[model samples]
Each structure stands twice: as C-alpha cells, then as structure tokens.
Target: MAYNVLSVIPARKGSKGIPRKNLRQLGEDPLVAHAIKKSKKSNWIDHVALTTDSQEIAQIGRQYGVDTIIDRPTRLATDEIPLAPVIEHAFEEVDHEFHYVLCFQPTAPLVSVDSIDEGIEAGIDSNADSVVFVRDSTHIYWRDGENGYEPVASDRKNRQQMDEIYQEIGIFLSENHIVRQGRRVGDSSEFYEVGMYEGIDIDTYADWILAESQLQRKQVLYRLIGNGNAGTGHVYRGITIADRLFEHDVLFAVEATEDLAIEKLEESNYDYQIFENEPSFLDYVRSTQPDVVANDILDTSAEYIKSLKEYTSRVVNFEDLGAGTDHADAVINALYEHSNPPENHYFGFKYFCLRNEFRYADPRTAIPSVERIMISFGGTDENNLTAKTLRALSDLDHELHLDVVLGLGYTDQGSLDSVTATYPPNISVEINQNVQSMAEHMEQADLLITSNGRTLYEAGSLNVPVISIAQNHREQKHPYAHISRGVLFLGQAEYVTEENVRTAVEEYVTEREKRETMREALEGHDITNGVERIKQIMFNQNNAD
Candidate 1:
C-alpha cells in the first residue's frame, strides 16, 4: 500500500533563544532552507508544506519551492502553543490528502533525506501509527532530588553493553488522521535511529553555532618545517596525511628555508604559506585560527606548542620527542620506538604514514642473488651520504648494477657529477627522479641501501632487504631499522667508511639465505595500514574535547 507523505517544515519568526533563528544564515543558506532542501530531495515526500505566521517566512518558503504554504494564525504561533496544532493547521491548508505527515522541524536542519524515507518505511513495515527520528542516548539519564543520581535503567552496564535508549531528534512521522486530531502519536509508535551527527537539533544560540560548525568544513593547518639540514621526510609525511583528509580544508605552513617543502606543496596544488621566522609562523597561525594544527617539524618547544594551542582547538605533533610533546593533544612518532610512551604519543611502525605508491604496491619476492642494488637516502642527504655511498660502491669488485637515487635537496651536484664521471660501467645515477617510480625501483632491485629514516619503513613494506646507514645519531635509534627487523644497520654515516659499504654490499650480495630471511622478516610488519590507523587517532584526538 502506497502512502502519500506530506513533509511539513514549521518555521516561526519569533524565537526566544535566538531571534529569527530559522531565517539566520547557516553557512551559505538559512537554517530553514536546510530543512526545505532535505524535504524537497526526499523520495517519500509527496509534497512539501511550509507552515509559518510571518509573511517574510512565507516568501522564503515560496522561494524554496514549497508546494503548499500554510499561513499559521498568530494565536497558534505563540511559544506556549504545541507543535501538533501548527501541523494540523498545515494539513487543513493543503488540498491533496496524505496518509502520513512528516513533521520536519526547521530547527533540526541536520536531519537527512534518507532518515525521512527510512522512518516512513519503518513505520509502514511495523504497521505503527507514528514514527520518530531518535538517537542513542544510552549513558545519559535524569536525576531525582531525594534519590540523588541513579542509572535510568536498573542494569548499570557499560554504554555499549546496555540496552539502546533513544531520544527523539525533532523529526516525527504520524498518521494524517492522528495529526488532524492534534496528536503526534496514537497507541502504536515506532522509531528510526539516525546517526549522532545527523540527529543534531538547533534551538538555542549555542546549538545553532554548533550546527553551523558541523555543516562547515574544518580548517586543518599542516605546519611542516623541512630544510637541507632537516630532510624532506616531514614534508612528505605532512602531504601524505593531508591528502587522506579530503573532507577537511588542508593548508601547508612551512619555513622560508624549506624550498623543497614549498615545491612539493605547489606540485600537489595545495594552498601554502612560507614563514621567514618562528614569530611570523606563530602570527600566521594566530591569524588563520585553524580548528586543528598538525605540526610535522620534528621536536616542538613547550612555548611553541602552547602558542599553537591558544588558537587551535586540536594540536597534533609528528615525530616529536621534545618538551612540547607533553602539551600536544596527540603525538605521532612513527620513526622512533619507545618502550613505554605517553597515552597521547602513538609510536612505532603502526603509525608510519606510508606513501600511496608504497602502501598499495605488492611486496617484491626475494630473488636468488643480489643482481641490482638501489640506493636511496631520503629527499635531502644533508650529510652527503649519497656521494659517500656512491664512492663506497665504486670500490665494489663484483660485476653488478648499482642504481643511485638522488634527492631533490641534494645540493652537492659537483660530488654527484664526479662520482658519475668516475662511476665504473656498472654504476648509474638517477637525480631528482619522480617519487612515484620509487616503488617500481624498490621492486626491481634485489638489495636496498638507505638511511634509517622514512624510506626504511617504505622498503620494509616492499619486503626489500636493506643495509641501513643512519644519517645522524637520532636515526640510529630507530627500532624498525634495527638488525632484529632484518635491516643491517651500518652505524652513522660520519663513521661509515668506503670499505664498510663495499663489505656490507658484498656480504648481502653473496649471502642469498640472509637476504631471503631479511625479506621474510621485513614483510611480517603491518606497515600498509599505518595511514588509516594514524588518521583514526587524529580524528579521535580532534573530537576528544
């Protein structure tokens, strides 16, 4: 049996909490317009009837393309008058007969079209006289003065374990006859559960503000400070995470010295601003007033984090171990692993933000012998480790190909040029190559020589046996690059001589068993899901307050 559903949007001019609340602008449209749009888009709604006392509201309803405009009398528009009379007045105005009346309050703009259709279907299927839109209010309860505070139900179970308690979210579906009698529900009534986000009801000024904020997209400021001294790992990590958060408006904030970081942001077509100093950066952040600030500048100072917290509601730091980490709402240290980190600090390989190319690429199968070797030491080899590794590989007596991957920030082109000129027929260098091809190179190569940085995790995901050389003492502490994880961590680059690289390369090349074992061990780690895990943590932290 088909039911003719009449969607009634009641918008009164007078509001005690917020004057003209229904007509007030919410984002691009007015509060009442939201309900009008939802009703018009609904598949179950046969006709939309907007009830209002004010002529201005009637004009607005006509502009919104409502089929019937019910001019509610001043007597029935009083605050003391209930919603049932106003709905009944609307039913008397419309010519077409409707089986059910969907009372969609203008104050509850968050109501979705799907919920309207679903509620109607549920009410029809259950053969109920009325249906109401509800949200799970399991833990919430009222208290009596004499009895003090007590659980609403006898069973004081966990919120998830407790029986679902739903509260009406201002959307009511009632039989046309019951509504005509000034009653929202008869004896039989059912309910449709809408998501918490969609069940938001706007009544007061605070509620309107909250509803408006929910409707608008959040501004996510990514503070990524990377330079020649500090490799481009932070920049890449910031971009990777920002790319995943398509729902939010992402903006990159970098230092002037971070040219490579700026270039990457530009290449990705992301909005960004370069700050000359800390003061300027802080000023910019203050001016923007971002909802959330994701700091990817390694260690953050207490004062810096405090200043950021002053403007932004949520502050997230990436790979931060400084005094500021304690102040940040969430800290993600994916490169370094700590035995017992703070509750906010999410450490280890589980939070490693891998690039889409590496995360989606299939892990390379271990070959019988090391035929082709790939060398990658992050975006900026500040220590000139690339040349050092190249020099070391020059001494290799074995007849095997060496593919040298140069970073964008690798300034010492003279050293690289000299190495290429003198490079034996076996060695070849590819400078400033596309990052997307990095995964392909990792797949083709039998062995990888890289710094103990972000690339280590990427290589591990690819199941490539790696000889990790630490750029500094900090990189050496990375647990993922440890020997236990199958990475032959050749100490700091400053101490690593040409002989050390030659010897390590030769050992890995000759020893097939060791390479295969290392490949198996690296593949055991779940690094592909790190982006999603970190996203969840950030989302939780953003909503923690």
Candidate 2:
C-alpha cells in the first residue's frame, strides 16, 4: 500500500519573547492561521496534523480543519529540546505508518501553498531521503580572513560573480526512514528555496513587528463575506449571544441573502456562510457543517431542520415570528404561539430590554453617576435615525456624554464612520455594540438616548429615563408613548431636534425625584436571564429525546 503524507505543526505554550504569541491577531488572522491555511491548501499532503502541548492551540487548530491533533508532553515543548526528538515522540504517540512527513512551524504567518507543495514534491520526485526549505539571505555576510572592513565581494557591483548565500529556515520534509535511521536529514537531501517574506519566523519582538507590518500593509485582499440577515436586529442579537457563548473566532451559519443583514455582518467582520435559496442552503450547510448554527429565519423546513439535527447536536434558533414551524433544538422568541410553539420556547424578556442584570453593583449611586448615554437601534436601523439623535444631543447645555449605536442594517458604514469621526468628542459614539455586553455598558448610563425599539424595553426594565427618538411609524405609536410618561419618546420626525434633546436632558438633570419615581416603577421588571433557563430546558429535552 502507498504511504500517505502527514503534516505536523508543533505549537508550544511557554514562550520567553512574546506572551501567547500563537493566538495574537495578525492583520485579519492569528499568527498560526497562516501556517494552518497553507497546510490545508496543500494537495500532496494527505492529512494536516497539529502536535501541541497547549489545549488552546489545539482548539484553534481544530477550527481550521486539522485532521488529527497529538498532545505533546511538557518535556518536548521546552526551549532546550531538539526538533528530532519531538518529531520522534509524535511518531510514537500517533502510531501511524506514513511514507513522508512535513514539519511546519506555527510562528510563520505567511507560508504559501506552493511552498508546501514544493517541499512535498521534492521529497517524492527527486528520490531524495529528505527535503528542507531554505531562503536566500541578503542581510548576513562573513568577513574575509582577518576581519577586514572591506566588502565581502572582490567586485561589489559584479552581479553574477557573488557567491549565492542560503540559510535553512527549519521547515523540513523527511521520510520515516530518515527519522528511524536516527538522523536529522538523510544522506540524500534536497534544498527548496522560498521567498524572503515567506521565510520570516516569529520569535522575537522584531520578527513580530515585521510580520504584522507585512500583513496589515498588504494590498489586494480577498473580499470578505458578510454575516447573513434574518433582520438587522436578528443578526446583531445572534452575534451578541454567539460571541459570549463561544470564543470570538467562532463562525455562524445564517440563512440570509446578500442583503443589508449580510452586509452588516461583513462590516462587523465575522466568518459566516450564507444560504441564498432553499436548495443552496442545503448544499452550503452540508459542506460547511459549522460547530453551532444560529438560525434567524422563521421558515426553516422540516426536512432541513431534521437534516441539521442529524448533522450537528447544537442548533440555536432566534426567531422573530413563526418560531415553532419546523421545531429547532433551541428557540429564542419574544412571544409564543399556540399552533407552532417551540419545544423549548424562551419568552420572558423582549429583544430590546435594557441589560441591567447587575448583581455586584448598587443601582441608585450607579445610575445617576453614569456620565455616558448610548442610544442604539439593534442590528438593522429599520430607519437610520440614531445618528440624527446623537447630533441633536450634541447641543445639550450641561456637557453630557452622548453615545450612538449603529445597527448592522444601517445602509452604509462609511457614512456612519465619517459622521462619527466628525461628531463632537465630548459625546462618545459606538457602532454595532451587538447585544452581548451592551447591557453592562447600558447599566452604567445615567440615561438612555435611544430609538423606540426593543432597547426601550431594555431601558424601561431598568427604569432608565429615555430620550426616545421614534424612527419609524410603528415605533412612534408603540414605544414613543413611554417618552411622554418620563420614559420619553420623541416622534420619529418631530421631537429629535437638537433643542428637544437639550430640553429632555435638562428636565432629567433638574428633577432628581423623577429618577427615584421611575426606579420604583421599574424595580423587579428585568427578566433577560430567561434565555439561560430556556437553554437548560432545551438541553434536558434533547437528552430526553
């Protein structure tokens, strides 16, 4: 039987130079991501394996489609250790027979697919016992005999006469025979020269800075795909929850077209797969098979839902309407329906309920002293009016802090970014705070300057007086009425002027007794924790089923 080619990436935890350098974000990806990506792209190698002493690196390697991971002993990861011993150690643990193996370093963040292919091909094609990648060095030279200061070359300008200089960059490929023979590289060896940039290794601060500069300054990058939209609110809410539950690097499979929701997702810079139509949706889901899927759609088919259930154990649904139509493993909804209710329905808190689930802090002293007020309209702005409200509040008399939140559904991020750049500095502004820790940020606010959306319920639940900007007709009728009763809703088009915003801030500042009155009305009203309770219910039901 022909032996399969195996790739090994050894990543150790302890480092003397940079702390946790493997996980550091370089440009759009982490340092190790470059090596992992190159390994996956190689056609010659059968399996891309990672041998790591760190659990965190293993988790990260798994995300990028590593076939098998070998946990190395602490002894092998030390700085004094040799690569040959570690490589031999991995062979003992895996107990797999292979024709050839490639040793990859996790520190190189710019390895190319061709470089991997070249090393593997050289090993197989040249009938060589071992192959290693080396690069030409322009920076290093040795003095002639007695350490003379003259140029190393007899004729400095002679292009062809200069001796070619090359150095091994530690990326090597060898057959099992070479290692079993107890030799680092066998007698028959081949050297494959790669580019200078691709040969860079990240070990010290200098190496890290150079790699980061290369990544960040590189022009012509792949166009990023946006997170899909069920609605602007739905996308941000889902991302908020997903970010908290999993690491920030987790990807979500969303059922959305290339709409505003997806665009917003793109702007927020998340790895996502979008299903354009029903048939495409199935193909996309089967191919990607994400760890967890956050479904914002109301109309997931029974066949698709069942297929998803079979494929993965974790499927969380965030539905605005028609939640129980096909029955997801877990469903988060604002209201329950009799005909099609989810098996484990989450229905205690509204989507925009203020995130005031504070247990460690006092409310009275905490509330009034909050210098900043953040006004956000969920993921999609439905109406792009939150920016206007921030502009209006800029004219307030007492030099109050103002923050405006942008949704993923906003028409353009460039316009918003530009507007935010020009907005007065005394007023702080934030975009797409998502839904996760937004409540924590909101809990510290003296007041909420917001639109009459689900966030109003969030503020009302906390009894935070709102200078409501009613951006839509529906919101004007629904949540704007609270603004009149001190929950303060300004009409979508009418009350959002600079003068009105100043008046609202003045009233709230002057009336200290009103703060107490509102607090009493809102006490014991928040119930966002029901999401957790529903999660438990779904988990138990899944086990039962």
Candidate 3:
C-alpha cells in the first residue's frame, strides 16, 4: 500500500547566508523549484506544496505550479527562530489529513524524488516516530572541551573499522502528531542514508560552490563486461577510464555472471550495480539517464549500441569492431587497424588508455643482455599459455631469472606452481598476481613475453622488448604487436609449438644485439598519452552533440 504523504518545502527569502538564495538559480531552476518539481515525481508522495515568507518565493512557487502555498508570519521567518515553529504553523495552515509530513529544505537542490520516496518508505515500514535522512560520515567527531576541543571517541580507530556515524542532512519525514507538536523528530527514528552527493545542503557559499560544481559534471555509466574466459583486461581498462574521470559521477554496470569483474571492482573501491541480462541493464540505463555510456566490452552489436543511445546523450564504445561503430557517436579502438572503417570509428595506438602507473614509467631503451624475463598472458590466460610457455623454457641451459605474472582470474595456479618448482636453482621463477605496479616490473625486465592486447601498449610505452603471442584470432588482428612496432609477432597460441616458443626464447637469450634493437625500435611509437587522448575524444563527441 502507498503512504499518503504531504511534502512542504520551506523557503524564507531574506537570508544572512546568501541574499535571494531561494530565487537564485541552481543549474537551470531556482533553488525552491527543485524540491517542488522533484516531489511531484514521487510515486508515494501524494501532495507537494511551498510555505515561504517572501512574496518572490511564493511567486516562484506558483511559477512551478505547486498544489498549495502557505504564507508564514514575519516573526517565524526570522533567522533567530528555528524551523520547527515555522513547520508547526504551516502544518496547521494546510489542514490536510495526511499519514505523514515531509519537510524538504529549499537549500538542498540536490534532493531527488527517489531520496524522498526512500525516506517515506522507511517511515512506513519501520513505523518510527520519524525517518531521518542522513549521510555516512567518516570524520572523527570532536567537541569543545574545558581547555580545548577533545575527541568524541574513547579511542582512535581506522575509518573502515569504526562504526558508521549518521549525520542528518536536516531533511526528514515525521508522523502527523509530531508535526503538530512543533517537533521535527521524536525519540524513535529510522536513519535513512541518502546518496553522498544527493544529501548536499547549500547552507554557505562554500557549499553553494560545491553544489554548483557537482551539477556541472556529467553522470557517466561505464558498461564493463568481463569473466574468467573473456579475461579481466576489459575490466581493468574500464577501471582506468573510470579512475581518470574522477571529476564526473562514474557508475559501473557489469553482468551478474561476471564475478571476476565484481571482485576487481570491489578491490578498486568504486560504486557499481549488477544486472542479470540486457533488458534489466537497459532498464537501469533509462533510470540512470547517464549523460554518456562508455562500453569497455571489446565488441558491441549494432542493436546493443542503438538501445543505449535512447537513454544516454552520447554512446562511446571502446575496441569495437561490430556494426555499432556506424551508429555510435564515437568508436575508439586502440589496437585494431581498419582499411575502410565507419566515419565514427577511430582505430590506432593514440586512443589506447594506459594504466596510471605507466604514466611515470621510464623506458629501458638499452639492455646489455636478457637477465630478467617477464611472462604474462593477461589476467585469465584463457589459453593456458603461461604454463605451456614455462614448460617450454624448462629445458633451457642458460642461467637466467624468470618472472611469471598471472592474472587474479587465472584458474590453474597449481600448474604454474608445479612448473616453478621444477626450474633449476640457477634459473629461478617468481610468480606475481594483482601487481601494484606493472610498469615497475616492465622497467626492470630486458624482454617481456605477453599476449597481443592492451598490455602490449603498456610495454610499448616503456620501450620494453616484447614477444607477442595471440590469445585468440581476435587478438591476432591487432596491428600494434607486429614486427614493425618493435614486437616479435608469434602466431596464435594453439598454432605456435612448445619448440617454437623455446627456440624464440633461446634466440632472444643468446642474441644480445637483437633484443637491444627491438627495445630501441619501441621508443619510436608514442603510446603514453593515450588516456588523455581518449578522454578528449569522448568529451569532443559529447560537445559536438
């Protein structure tokens, strides 16, 4: 059953904080109009009206077409008087038989219909004296002591370990009796935490500036897809882009089946949602109405891109080869090459988005001989090339150190461990996962053996000599791994024999000048500034629209 709710937006115009604040513009609407329009959209909120002392405020209220406007006395309108008496007078003036009353401050323009509904729903379900809308605070509480300010807690603790403290945003839904009694809340209350940004109240100029800044940034939804089979490169790529877009409101949407993506996202500490299928995902897109949809899933279908365009302002697909390139605003592929591509399609190394650590990585332009060998087949190593390549090298007579880097999603850790134990004491093996800094390892290595993917671009940036083996046919098509670009392009893993890998490893190990030449050739390709370039492309397309 729906609750009968009355929303009263209070806006007293003559202000000490900021003059004409209620009438002042916030984004496109006046401050008071935000609550009024948002309240009207609530499915559970029955009626929404304005109660203000200023005639200008009332005129703005009527301009927005509120259901009712209650005039407040000059005495109750003063800054000295609290909101309780003003709300108390307005409740008496309205004369409506409502199940509950909601007081939304005009200063809080960030409030949404969803937040209001959540508060009301909590009030009804819990049947508390009031429902207090609050936000989670991590800051340590302090109070003015006899001599100086003192900590509110008995002991200091980390933010994660400490119990969450709910600080009210001065927005609440209370029982009818409490409103009549000139009280905003009672003894019993349910604490409902609003979104971090939505609870922002514009009290002072600093808060007003912050609210305005938040309004200016776009709401971006990153549609990331990954799994044990697909590999976590796409997920990491999406996270890199999301991390770069710290200015915007970035939210990730991944499939429910992509547990690897979920685990990685959790470790990255970002906000995300899980959907079962395409229909539910599109429903989320409609509800979110994201300004831009950035898809990091390698290829996107024309039908999928078309569906996303309906709900978003701009549709951007990364590493896309599907027919969707023609329909999408921008299709940026950092690896593949196309002879006759769609007008919207952009293919090449310039669009590659590198991880943050690579930005500071120095190129090992000169290496005397191959001492440290780095082997990585991406996160999943879906092809099981790491073990095959490791086994292929076990017969090597050369004295060298092998550094095996596997993905977190790698299923056969046991196989890699067993192979590591078999290596001679002179030829050591070090296996690493969830590497804090990929470039650090790349910087120290004389030669790197990796799959033909985004990792190739990372190696290219640091002039790390690479032996590329294609993970699949799709990866074989990537032109960046070719001999011309400083990498020895071995055919797909299945076609390449264990002898073929060992032969190549022996050649690089034995030939000192060959590895040096490849390392120097890598310096010609400029791939470090890709993340910035990609950001420009996404924003340029958005600006064009």
Best model number under lDDT: 3
TM-score of 2: 0.45
Model 2, poorest ten-residue lDDT window?
A: 217-226
lDDT of 1 by residue, 350-443 (tens): 8898988787687877578767889888666768888888888876666677777777656677887888788676655565544656887887
What is the C-alpha local distance difference test score of candidate 3? 0.84
How much lDDT does each candidate structure score?
A: 0.82, 0.62, 0.84
In terms of lDDT, the poorest run of 10 residues in model 1 is 536-545
lDDT of 1: 0.82
How large an RMSD does model 3 have? 5.1
- Please list the Cα RMSD from the true structure of every candidate, rounded to 1 decimal place: 17.5, 13.3, 5.1
Per-prediction TM-score: 0.63, 0.45, 0.77
Q: Backbone clashes in each candidate structure, one number apiece?
A: 0, 12, 0
Query: In model 1, which residue pairs have backbone atoms overlapping below 3 Å?
Result: none
**On residues 1-545, what C-alpha lDDT tens digit does candidate 2 reach at each position?**
45477777777777779998887777777767677888888898777778888888888888888878888988889999988878777655665688887888777667678888977787789999888888887533547576666566556644455567777776888888776665558788999888887777888989888777665431110111233222455555544444343312355455454465566567767676665665776566567564454556544566666766665556656543442345565665542223354455554343221222433233433355446777776555655566555555654545556655555445656656765676565556666544445556666677877676566656655556676776666456453244235476556755457677767767776677776665565554543454444334333444311
Worst 10 residues of 3 by lDDT: 536-545
- Give me the runs in candidate 2 sitting further than 4 Å from their true place: 1-122, 125-128, 131-173, 176-181, 187-231, 245-249, 253-259, 298-304, 323-326, 334-342, 350-452, 457-463, 466-515, 521-545
